[model samples]
Target chain A: MSPGSVGTVATQHLDLPGSLPLDCGRSLRRVRVAYETYGTLSPARDNVILVCHALSGDAHAAGLSPDPPPEGTRDGFAAAASPKGIGWWDGMIGPGKAFDTDRFFVVSTNLLGGCRGTTGPSSTDPDTGRPYGSAFPVITVADMVRCERAFLAELRIDRLAAVAGGSLGGMQALEWATSYPDQVNNIVVIASTHALQPQGVAWNAIARESIMRDPAWQGGDYYGTGRAPDAGMGVARMVGHITYLSAPSLAEKFGRRLQSGGDLRYTLHEPEFEVESYLRHQASSFVRRFDANTYLHLSRALTYFQLDLPAAAETIMARTLLIAFSSDWLYPPSASEEIFDALRKSGKEAEFHLIDAPYGHDCFLLEEARQTPIVRDFLTEGRA
Target chain B: MSPGSVGTVATQHLDLPGSLPLDCGRSLRRVRVAYETYGTLSPARDNVILVCHALSGDAHAAGLSPDPPPEGTRDGFAAAASPKGIGWWDGMIGPGKAFDTDRFFVVSTNLLGGCRGTTGPSSTDPDTGRPYGSAFPVITVADMVRCERAFLAELRIDRLAAVAGGSLGGMQALEWATSYPDQVNNIVVIASTHALQPQGVAWNAIARESIMRDPAWQGGDYYGTGRAPDAGMGVARMVGHITYLSAPSLAEKFGRRLQSGGDLRYTLHEPEFEVESYLRHQASSFVRRFDANTYLHLSRALTYFQLDLPAAAETIMARTLLIAFSSDWLYPPSASEEIFDALRKSGKEAEFHLIDAPYGHDCFLLEEARQTPIVRDFLTEGRA
Candidate 1:
């Protein structure tokens, strides 16, 4: 293993002891969570920072995975996929990294509605002994947080030094603080929002529509049908990829450069621009690795992540550290400012930092070195 | 009928006398154009203003269509669809409007590769007596302008007082100014760019992918299959709808408002936000009237609109007027500034007006009143 890295790790699974209640009022039995841990758990189990994964993320948040999936978790131009087995957030979680595995035990779990080794729409229904498919109940960020809490209970880790994440993962961090206020000491919400802006909501809606519209989706029952909504899900991934990036970044990287030499090829069904080819690559890569039904559910969950934080603001125990990037239109810094304002209004400890960055929402993952000092300072304050 | 209104107009068709050559080194024969004309032709034959339409637009640019199609040729929330038969740009092309039909003979035509009563992909291929479909030649903005020039020749109209349009339409205007500089007096290009930026290219690519991925598209040969790529086209339209409007406009209009009740319903398939429903409505309504292949071709032409302006700068005669909106990200004001800079560099007469509006690229259509005086002044100078 590389210096300061958590080395190669294996994912572990746990079945919750009871039914996992969903926001849709349905209870999902046989709920299982896939997780990975870095560093040793202290005797008191207090030096814990539960790391949450965002949309299209898995439990492998840091270090090297002994066995990487055939499709590999990383999307092109998003992370440090130096080698295929490197974790999605390997830059930020290590012995001397932002999470500082030397001082804290870090736990990362796939969200409830995820397709990555978790009980999701792809999982079997206890009653029918078939994939839940369309029968899977809708979930919300709170339910995801609830599943994380239940998973932690099995590990005998009742409280956490921090609950942290970015994008949807950040939403989960915010949910963790509010849902289990007494259990978490600090919450780091990066490049996320209390509720998506209307335009953001519209993009997510378009993505879900793209997936569900595919005839091969078969109303979310394509499992074992020898067909999948890869086409539709490919479109969904393309849309998401564009939204996660800033205009300037695209300009700097691809600009108006053609994929081929000089002359224009007047074809309707082919990619012409470098950016067009990049998006197609991303779409094809994503459709192979991700499940369409899970995309629909998780995208819906993130859009439904409107927090009733004011209601739970009073008894919240966690101190909030909100970090947002200027170019993150998906989850603008204004949302973080709103959170900080509300927390201050409730006399809760909070800090909101707007990083003037150009990487857009992906900055939370790509701008790791710049974020490390700020995150380490915040974590140190918590220890004080 | 109504004050300052043209009252009513009918679209007329004309067949080109010969084969029209394309930029791709191919030729389209037996080409037809659908057009509408208002006001009188001057004795001197210099009072003609050739108006062009953007993607999804047609020859019916003003007045009322006596016989509207079943789909009504209207997308909800786009234009003044107050009375159904109203032309898409009726507000800006009437008796005392910006185009001032009382003074100038305003001519509007469905573009070359259009589905609206013009020769396009849906047009019959003489070789097989079947719709062009996959056999349709790929077209560019220059090709559309070439077709327009041919269509005008059939009318014995040699010179244009001005050529004007917005977005993709604006690209056509720029093409005419350079391609036939000696034949045109002035040009009005609104919310357009000499070359589409990489981000814009990415969005267009995504929309195209959405349509092509639909099974019903059948590789653009779904004409007689009793089905269309409506599902994919719907998703494409949804994407276009969002991109055409600004985020602040969407936030102000919808503002995280729920679709049904005050609380969340927790449904995966159904839309939760008002913006989501609005997009669906826009998508569904669009697919009903617009041809998917036409959309694909037009979108491609617009993306491939990168101009070698510097090469064509010398020996160009038209005075240029470019207008852009502050919030128009799809065709941002920066593009207008670029055009102005390029024109000035070439010692050409050019004027650029950046209107500080919040409607985004749709501003060129919606901000008719604000654009009137500016357009009027520019036209008045041409006649002076």
Candidate 2:
């Protein structure tokens, strides 16, 4: 029930005719892209903006979903309060929100290595007649952009008014701009970087280790097995849940308040602190909806993302809108500043808007109101 | 060798004559403590400076340990470069170093609920003649201080010239000052806090969850099971290790360097990034040395530490020295500032020094040279 939420929508999938080449030097024979669209394509198809999803996100970026996927799509804290059945970015893509579906068509897609109806590790390999699981080729952000481009080509959309997303999705948008500079008119990257900082790399590494170490993971071939690496994935989610939030935000949400009413329960196995309990809840919920191998693939790909934005400076015709959150230690404002500085140095038209927000990297998804004017004005003014 | 090294020390054990009371409303019988001493006791016994160790450290503080613990004592990433046979803080506690063993008899002990030859979850329970394991009562920082007080009492020492430590050890130091306010004359709390911040709480919680979720942990009673929760504990260590260092330090140390030259190995099962490889090595080494049950107990104990320093203002006679590193996001200078503000507001003697270092929480162990002068000046100035 957001002010301008796009009405109920369903994800649709399309298969690429040719094999999609991956950075791993392996090509996927049957590549499928699951997508959802808000707004309408103009007669010339010049108003279409390609939207990408983050590490755990999917095609349903805005509007209400007709059906909840087997695993819930709601991740992050405050998820319980987020309008149920609504898209992840429901607040930012509608008649009058940030993306402004009224004037421009916004299309979101599940990334190349996603599990949500996207041909990923969980998908059956046509050659082996088994889930790809361990057989899925390692993909890169560039490869994801390639898949998105091919998916759009099937729709007969050769050029885009813009490409946009946050976190991993933002990486995809950057890939689109850098790889197909002449095709994308503008790029909106939020709470992302040209490269993940080292600590961020370490966090992702630990998360992947957690999943792989689980005996249930069974060498990434656990799909046929009834059991999943839920415990390990839960721990991974907990780590990610904390990273997506700033310390101050956690402090405000759950301080050292004990789960028990007053005194310490004096139990080692049970959750004591309110934060501990919250983390457990977050972890459990995350493990249920996400695929472990898909997580490993996506995490590895994002970790490997190192954009040479400067090298593509000459060919890039896109007017870039780079938005970063001040409290996003995972993707700090310094990275956005680096991007902006590089773009300006190359004499490219760009606007960098750093939102002074406290929610950490989650700010990109949560701070919809603040981002509206900036994104709207940027896109509209670029046209003007 | 460290300058003025208190060379070739051995950990010694002593059993308390009576049962020690615990915060869990239970008492531990036949409680034993392992300790190492540097310098010599004065005729008046007033020259004793009790130095506590951090979460993973033991009684070995300023010298070359004559006998290496079975699993080895080195835990940091720079363990290879760190001098062999030396204590974790060998550089910081010698005759002319921070503790200045030349003037003061420095006493170091394996903390209560520690795995290092102390009466902890890994130790034998007098009643069952078996390892306490999950049966061990949860202990707190105050309980650790109480045990320290009892251990010192057994040695016929009624008061301490100073009590000092970093991280978890610093928590115990603050606990000592507040619990036995009249017994401790001065306290040096470095890169530690009165209470763990919410984010820190989350990290520790995730770590504990990592261990508990491992099937081999067997509800924390896996001591004799032949199968240890090495995988889970390794993941826990990886998480803890990353948190202990700054992002920039990792960037400087590892960057985006690949383990195999410059190409992606295109494998998910193996470590590709140098940081990932380093983490695996660190985790395996840590899992081999550390006890998972003891980790659970100690992690739980530290999480429960929420010292209300201002509440004990009237009884506190100790002059406090608070040292915080600039890059220590884990502990942070803001926490030290809070402690300083509380003491200052209570009209207590306190000095707050913020060192501009980049090692993060590990600064307490790595930036020994920078800390020595501040600690020595603080201790000596108090004596003067």
Candidate 3:
């Protein structure tokens, strides 16, 4: 076993009884949540930390697969996972890491509308016994928090030591602290905005349009049609990927640089620029795992979410830490500053840090070296 | 006729003898140019100003409909034109406007790949007597300049008083001064870049993808099919429209303010934001007038174009005036500065002006109050 490897981890599903009422006045008769836990819960249950995943993230937060796959066996996320089977944010959640599994219990779950083993559009409808598809009720970030809170209740963890995430995950964390003020003591929001900007919403709208406009989308009921709108979904991914990157980053990586053996001449259907090739690859790889309907539902949730920090500041009990990247135009530092200003105006304790990371919004995921220390310092000391 | 209107504007087609050679080693025998001339050509022929139009623009510069519509009478561009037969640059090319058609004869032509009565993909193939369609030879900005040069020779015009345009038109202006240094005396390039940015190219690539991926496109031969890929073309325009406006402009103009009677809840295929509605309008109106293949060709030309000022500096005889908008992210001031710097390094006379216009790249066409004075002052004087 490699050093620092999370030896074994297991993801468990919790099927909660009773209807999960949503903000849209709709309710699911039964809700299923797939989650994973690391470290032992303290006797007092005071060391439990909840980690929220981003838009397309799953429950597996840290640690290796419980059973090593046999030679040549590859399937699901297991194949995508590292040799350690560690989850997203594994760098900050393991033993001696920021979240410090050895010192604090860490829990992660697939978001409510996510396709990864969660109760989403892909989940079987209790009444129809078929995938919900376009029939799936829309969910908000607050609803996702409520769902996650239910999972926490099932585990008998009354209060969270800390709630942390980035981007959409950060939105979820903010919602958790805002909705259940007493349940979370600390909050870390990175590269996120209190409310999605109109420009951001514009991009999301176009992405959704790309998918829904596809004939193969079949009005989001392509599950039984034997064909999916992979091309549309791919284009959406490509567009989204461009937003995730800064111009400077793209220029530095591929400034008019052509693909291998590529020329500067006009050729239809040919990717002359390296960036085009890169975006094409990103699009093709994304359609393999993501669900189109789930994307639609989650993207709608993002735009629909209205996070008024001034209103939430009065009720927010968590000591907040907001981190934003300098080059993240999608969710610029001004967004975090807005939340921080509101917290200050409300007489709440908060800290805001703008990292000079030119990697754009995805910096939270890619610049782990810079993000880990900042996150660790915030998580450990309550506020930086 | 309305006073100050460019009355009796006629679009004249000229067939130049001999073949027009292209950069790609292909030549079109007997090239046709659709152009509009305002004012009488001086006896010396030195009072002529060749006006270039941007992508999707046509041989229309200024003056509203020469004759007022009889209440509901509608015809071609005359229907779309303002009451005075005003052209796209109505603000800048009027009797007392910046270009001052009363003093200088102004000529504007539909670009090489344009569908507006010019020889393009929609034009008949002289050899086959059918629409060129996808078989149209790809054209570059330099090729566009060469075609315009042919038009000038056909008019027996030996020297131009000035050549001016904005955006893609600006690219053509630069190409003109570079290719035919002795033919043009002054050049005005506004809201343009010496070289296209990868990010901008990325957006163009997606827009083209949106059109090409449409099943209705039928490999660019959808003409006369009664069902062109309007949806895809519209989407492309929507994407392009977003790039043409600044985020702050969108925020100030539309914000997250939903369309009238719009809900905050999830609804499919609905434009919730006013900005989305605006984009839809822009896209729909564009698909009505613009051809899909022309968009592909022009967008490809933009990406493929590489303007090396050093190479053309020695031969560039036209004293140049470069203008950039303050909020034009698509082609910011830095791009203009690059050309200015190159001209300075090459010991050429040039002036660069950064205008404080927050309307983004389209500011050149929209913010003429600010642009008019700068352009007028430049054209009136020799050089800054």
Give one digit per residue, the lDDT tens place, for model 1 in B1-384: 998788888899999987999999999999989999988888887899999998988999888888876565445455444567777788799888999988999999999999998899999988899999989999999999999999998899999999999999999999998889889999999999899989899999999999999999999999999999999999999989889999999999888899886878878778889988888888888888899999999999999997766766675679999999999999989988988887889999989999999978988888889999999999888651
- lDDT, candidate 3, at A285: 65
Model 3, CA-based lDDT: 0.80
**Backbone clash count, each prediction separately:** 0, 0, 8
Best by lDDT: 1
Candidate 2, DockQ score (0 to 1): 0.89
Candidate 2, A135-186: lDDT as tens digits: 8888888989999999999999999999989999888888888888879999
Alpha carbon RMSD to native, model 2: 1.5
The 10 consecutive residues of candidate 3 chain B with the worst lDDT sum are B69-78
Ten residues in a row with the worst lDDT in model 2 chain A?
A: A69-78
Give per-model CA RMSD. 1.4, 1.5, 3.9
Candidate 1 per-residue lDDT, tens place, A268-334, comes to 8778888999998898888888999999999998988877657656766799999999999889999
Task: Give the C-alpha miss distance for residue A164 in model 2, angstroms.
Answer: 0.4
Docking class of 3: medium
- Please identify which of the two predictions, 1 or 2, would achieve the higher DockQ against the true structure: 1
